[model samples]
Target: MRIHLTSVFVDDQDKALSFYTDVLGFVKKTEVPLGEDRWLTVVSPEEPEGTELLLEPSGHPAVKPYKEALVDDGIPATSFAVDDVRAEFDRLRERGVRFTQEPLEMGPVTTAVLDDTCGNLIQIAQSA
Candidate 1:
């Protein structure tokens, strides 16, 4: 059993595409237009054939409140694994990305959270 795809709601696909690719370093995998919305997805550059992360539209009525509540409680919409949390955090910070939480160690794991700029917080983590 293997994971195929997952998604994160975005306010704007184009903007999210740029951020995910240019900043977050993911590569575009699929893009099929569907009027006001599109079926877009991205994959980690290092794992281009791995699980896909869909850039879904936040048009659903329930999504707004769900996202808001998560943000209000300082929760991440999703997490991505990194080789080194602190190094990744510094690399992103140097690119002008805004982080809501700095890297913190928790036992054998370290994590940091940052705003996705598309109305969601994303976490980067590393484990020993």
Candidate 2:
């Protein structure tokens, strides 16, 4: 079996949409309103039919502390593949995205972590 969909807990869906699309360069796939929240998801432009990334709301009580702990420990909530981690990091930094970790090479891979601006740390990686 293969992966289908995954999510990142967000504090604000609209802001997350803006960041994920306008800045991170993902394309919106679905948006169905569910009362005060929506089932919002996005996909990489290069893979329109691939796995979708859901921008789930962090309204649950446990989510707040869990997310906080992750942030406090400098851990990313999720990672996205990139052709070049350094290039992607530079491009994103130029757009004012705050990075917690600069691109670092580790054997066959390189990675950088950035704030999603909606209460999550995201990593961009390039693997050899």
lDDT of 1 by residue, 1-128 (tens): 99999999998899999999999999999999999899999999899999999999999999999999999999999999999999999999999999999999999999999999999999999999
How much does candidate 1 score in TM-score?
0.98
Reference-based TM-score of each model: 0.98, 0.98
Model 1 poorest ten-residue lDDT run:
6-15
**2-110: candidate 2 lDDT, tens digit per residue:** 8989999999999999999999999999999999999999999999999999999999999999999999999999999999998899899999999999999999999
Runs of candidate 2 exceeding 4 Å displacement: none
Q: How many backbone clashes does candidate 1 have?
A: 0
Worst 10 residues of 2 by lDDT: 84-93
